[model samples]
Target: MDENSHPLVKAALIHAQFESIHPFSDGNGRLGRILIVLYFVQSKLISQPIFFVSEELERERLRYYDLLNGVRGDQPDWSSWVLFFLTACHRMADKISTKLDAADKLAMDGLRRCQTESEKKVWVYTFSDPHTTVKKVSTQLKIAPSTARSALNALATKGLLYSDKQTKRNKKYVNYDLLGVLT
Candidate 1:
């Protein structure tokens, strides 16, 4: 299980070995999945280490455990594991692609609506940091509190941001669509 081998082969081997080790008292399953994503990034298979596994593994939880056990029992079950990995990769790729497409569309629409450079910067900042308060934005952008409030209110009016009315004067605003994009 040297990592210097072919990345796909190494990923499969390391994943199996990690499961065999069961190193952590808890979160071994999660750690193993994280290792898979990290391996993908380290091997340059993915530009970012953002792929997820919980739902995919949960969908086939029984079979996943069975395959791991089979491999531990010295059975030749690598092919099954490889197939499962490919299926997970496909699912993750599709999910991320859809998200990127939607984000791009939103960016284009937002850009078209934002006329000034400052407004465009505000939109970009909000998009990047969703669920932030006006105070935080003001502090980050070094703008006056009033200016920050105005920018946020304008975005909210355009249906790009929403907020839960907090009792405090410095209320928190959430980018609802951005959160939706993330989850």
Candidate 2:
């Protein structure tokens, strides 16, 4: 924090150090990854620790290991490791921001087409989990099971949700639009 370094670069250095030290036997790797987000939050680069880098790290796990190991090897390749870390951060931020924008637009569009408060609540809840059942929705929103089913049906009619299977009991509704946004 005292050095005049960029927050991302500083975070990368801290993460590399933690992983190299192998501070704990059980959760050092997980805690080191979480520290990246905590650093960003504390540095005021982000208001919340919501940004994620773990997925990208997991995808490039082999290369990630090599990079971390490189720093501890005979020839310390700090530059390459820092570059990889920054690239992962950039890619994740862009992907998450795009999905958030799409989800916001879908929420607005769904709300505009909703007819009742229950429908709106169900629609919003669907964004949290696009695949839901009437029982789950009813219990979560404190509405009757019949009312929840009606809301699900109404959303299905509006092309916002569809039945997952042709079953008589324990039916599931899926919100394709929200799913698309998420994926």
Candidate 3:
């Protein structure tokens, strides 16, 4: 906590030490990764707890373990471990930025293509509630179920949403374009 260094380097060192200690019987890895975010947030490096680095680490699982192990070996190699953590953080941030931008563009395009007020409402609702049915949208928007169904179908036709081939009794529509960018 008193380290006079960059937050990323400090977080890397803290994580490495925590892993080396291996305090818990399980969930040590998950908890160690979470410590990085908590440190960042408490240090005011980030205003929110959105800087998640676990996915990046998980992607390079072998290398991540190797580097951590290297740091804990007879001759500790802190440099490689810190560098890998920083690199993973950079890549994760870039990936998040790209996905967010793409999803925003898709949302704006879908809104422009909406034909009616109901369609626009349904499209907007999909942002908050990705999964919706005709009945759900009808209740949420206080619109006729038929009108909700029409708007959903129109969105599906526009390629903004996709409907599953479920029974006609209970059909579901999703904003696949936005979900695609996000997922």
Candidate 4:
């Protein structure tokens, strides 16, 4: 398709065509769904395939199958299938927006709990990677292992993070509140 075409329309057409081809015995649906994200990335429409359109499609599983089937029939209804695909994309985008907003709020709240700069850095890093170790935090933030350990422990003390309870070494800490916002 040409670049002038609307992105969702192109994505819908690509998805429908890919599903119609059904190239694989077991993974046609999986690959066809992934094609939607790959197309967006290939077209430079998005930097990441974090859209999660599959969640919305799975939520409307029966209708999704029906629309795809409608497209493959003798009297193919391309418009209806395209409309459903675009609508699913819209809903997934909205869902991601809401999750991002919630993540932002959680980060801000966690930041407020930090008593020191190191603690704040460790807390912020949790948003990027929920499961963390002192070594990872030290590497990422360029702090001493002792300082990273102290800061991680401090956040856990503040109820902002929870440790995975390995005392000697490589103990992992997680920000469950931030994870809740994200997942």
Of the candidates shown, which would achieve the greatest TM-score relative to the real structure? 4
TM-score (all chains, Cα) for each model: 0.82, 0.73, 0.77, 0.93
Model 4 agreement with the true structure over 1-183: per-residue lDDT tens digits: 667889889988888888888888899988888888888888887899887687899899999999988988589998898888889999988888999999998889888878899988889898888989999999998999999999999999888899856576789898898778777
Worst 10 residues of 4 by lDDT: 163-172
lDDT tens string, model 2, 5-34? 999999989999999999787998899999
Query: How many collisions between residues are there in candidate 4?
Result: 0
Candidate 4 similarity to native, TM-score? 0.93
**What tens digits encode model 1's per-residue C-alpha lDDT throughout 82-139?**
6786676678678888998888788778878876665676778887788787788888
TM-score winner between 1 and 2, please give it: 1
lDDT of 3 by residue, 143-173 (tens): 9999999999999888888886565778888
Residues forming the 10-long window of minimal summed lDDT in candidate 2: 160-169
What would the TM-score be for candidate 1 when compared with the true structure?
A: 0.82
Model 2 residue 112 CA deviation (Å) reads 2.3
Note the residue pairs that clash in candidate 4: none
- Per-model clash counts, in order, read 0, 0, 0, 0
